[model samples]
Target: MTSQSESTEPSSALHDEQAPVKRVRVAAWAADPLTLNGLTQALMGRLDVFVAAGELPADVDVLVVAADRVTSEVMVSMRRAAAQCSAPMVLVTNELDRTRLLGAVECRVVAVLHRSAATEERLISTIDVVAGGGGLLPPNLLGDLLRQVQNLQEEVLTPRGLNTSGLTSREVDVIRLLAEGCDTEEIATRMCYSERTVKNVIYAMTSRFNLRNRPQLVAYAMRTGII
Candidate 1:
């Protein structure tokens, strides 16, 4: 079943109710000019929102996209928006394809609003959340996202003997220290372990990942974002 727009929005009760202290820069876009104009106009009416004109500005804080449904073009627009300014986006649409929803998310869409529920109030509220580094999704797509995450954990991470970080906790400690220019003895001392344990951790990671030496290991960690 589908979720109501208001029902699926994240609860705002936890947010401070005080007046907004700063203006948020927003850019609205749509495949249709009328829809884009409407969204831009609605946001322009708010005292705390500065709707951007023409191309999205470099300092835009949020991007609002109105579409009839999620499409490849919409995903491209989302990517362009991310590349242009790195603003979190809100997708107001009639339908979002579950298969491509994660792709949109990777492009930085932080909220989803059903077109039917894209009221001025709802749009403003979602912009507030997105601007504050929060995210929301419809219940149906939320389930899909969770399922994909679970599948990744079960199918890929488990077989590799790793967790979400792609490195075990001890491995992280060892690699982190190595990246910081610590010798094995220093790492052992800092972690309160014997020097042999530190060597073992380094040996295990190198042997497992086919890295040749400590410098290579550190490089691997840095390249893969493990450190």
Candidate 2:
């Protein structure tokens, strides 16, 4: 039989391995006290979330705003709040339109949920996703977002000799292949470039955009509908 100490050692290791990650800090605000209080109450007791107080905490991982509608004044406030921190935001609103969505995008709002549809589980999941640097959008909103991106590309970026997504043609090609699971050597061979050249391309793109790695670059590309 195993010694008591030996058995305890494995159990201790397992406990450490299973330890939960740090909870995400959330700051929620709204035009009305009831809305704000309701949001905080809904998120209470969640294992991986901590609601914060005051004007958008500096260390907040996600900022949630409850609003009835997103107007020009709302967009202004969002931009000001966003300027104070780099955290992604989730907008819980009853109204969303193409223009308002675009405005929110400009303010770094990564997720939106209709107040009627914002269940506790869905809200928490969206917060988790945004905190992890992923974006969340309703399926119907996603199509509109893509169309807006395309129109902007056609009307403004194309005339300026820029790709719609701020990526060069070559960078887009490299990232598209990377997204498809091609190794550097395979990509170089296919593109008739040196392996060093392919690596340099990836490094340049990631460095310019502050992406942590190739996978993140691919995710960014996909989120922005570049590939």
Candidate 3:
């Protein structure tokens, strides 16, 4: 005969236990040895460390890249590192401007922390966001990012008849016609283009995106919100 209290105590203990949290896998890179050691030490225990001599671990969830200045040389190295690891990056820097901010995007960097303001808690929290497919940037960096997008759109993409989705105006018109079940000759007639020109447009889009057929291209347009 077991006492009711004994039975209840075990049940209470079971209820109190919690599942262990899964830690984010984090790797650190810096232009110099001292900064590298500092970042790795700061992130220890809070994250699962991934380190290798030659390459970043394929399973790393996030990478922290620290630099004194986000200059062209540092950005070049960061770009190479970003190529090696497809994981999102958190950049810690002493200085960053609009041009440098755009360069950071090229390196897959999702978060930017000013070196002066980045405490361990802040850095860890930023890494967690990047690991979760979210990002945080300071107000200044946010402004810079917006400016970069506007400039790129106004100066480059817009002039080329393209939008953020990388689809040109003509491409969008053709895709819209296709989605409306318009055949090539009908699309050409509606758009005042020759049938051969419409065919060339479709072929160009298919080749660019590697889509196999008209149906697939239409599906892609739908998926990408271009039509």
Among the numbered candidates, top TM-score falls to 3
Point out the higher-scoring one by lDDT: 1 or 2: 2
Q: Give each prediction's root-mean-square deviation over alpha carbons.
A: 14.1, 7.0, 3.8
- Quickly count the clashes in candidate 3: 0
**Model 1 stretches with alpha carbons more than 4 Å out:** 1-20, 47-55, 165-171, 175-185, 188-227
Better of 1 and 3 by lDDT: 3
Cα lDDT, model 2, residue 111: 92
- Write the residue-wise lDDT of candidate 2 on 92-203 in tens digits: 9998778777888888898999999999999999998998899888888889999998898999888876795677777888998999899999999889999999999899
What digit string (tens of lDDT, one per residue) describes model 3 on residues 73-163?
8887888888888999999999876777888887888999999989999999899889999988889888889988999999999999899
| Backbone collision tally, model 2 | 0
lDDT of 2 at 82: 88
lDDT tens digits by residue: candidate 1, 128-222: 89889899898888999989878878999878877766677778888989999999889999999999989998998999899899999999888
For model 3, the stretches where C-alpha displacement exceeds 4 angstroms are 1-19, 173-203, 209-227
Misplaced by over 4 Å in model 2 are 1-20, 47-55, 165-227
In the predicted model 2, the residue pairs found to clash are none
Candidate 1: residue 182 Cα off by (Å): 5.4
Model 1 — which ten-residue stretch has the worst lDDT?
A: 47-56
